[model samples]
Target: MKTPVVALLTDFGTRDWYVGSIRGVILVRCPRAQLLDITHEVPPQDVVAGAFTLAGAAPWFPRGTVFVAVVDPGVGSDRSLLAARADGRYFVGPDNGLLALALANAKRYAAVRLTNRR
Candidate 1:
């Protein structure tokens, strides 16, 4: 079996610890997982940009790749987190339409409104 890959796309520029913190947590949970950066330079709070970026690049990655995308302006609000599987790739991010464009390309897609607050 192939090792799983988790790609990260965030507006959290490289100057901060946000990306590092997320990477650390993923590493702790799945040390053997391969990590890839979609981009950390997305304009802050620009979910549209983040969504398009992921959609454009998602198809080229291996199937079963997981993408963690964050361009949230409503981070502290009651905005829900989303988990979506589309075109054989997995996505986790906010539910503010950030995943819509990407999920649109999926030949087979499914999403669930996550109730987990973590």
Candidate 2:
């Protein structure tokens, strides 16, 4: 009976309203979702920074955690979204090669590029 935690990583700055809006979107979708800000100051479009932040914190979190990363410079573009599974966790983000080296082991699970969520 534990609450699920959603670790969010993005390039949106704290000064802007993007981060807040994303949180709000999550809240509206799932009020019980525990939103954890991994980091908003991810070097402003720095994909590596975002991947590192997510890959670092993902392991320490409990099972069933969802890592939502949005360091995408290709947002709303044709870069295709991804939902990767690794080490008892789920990762949701774009397929921008940034995540190529995120995971520690990098060879544990299958990585899939999801165009649309079901």
Q: Local distance difference test, per candidate?
A: 0.92, 0.79
Model 2 poorest ten-residue lDDT run? 98-107
lDDT of 1 by residue, 2-115 (tens): 889999999999997989999999999999889999999999899889989989989999989999989999987899999999988999999998889999988889999899
Task: For residue 82, give model 2's deviation from the true position in Å.
Answer: 0.4
Stretches of candidate 2 exceeding 4 Å from the true structure: 104-107
RMSD (CA, Å), each prediction: 1.0, 2.0
In terms of lDDT, model 1 sits at 0.92
Model 2 Cα lDDT, one tens digit per residue, 17-85: 888998998899889999998888788778877777777777788878888888888787788887877
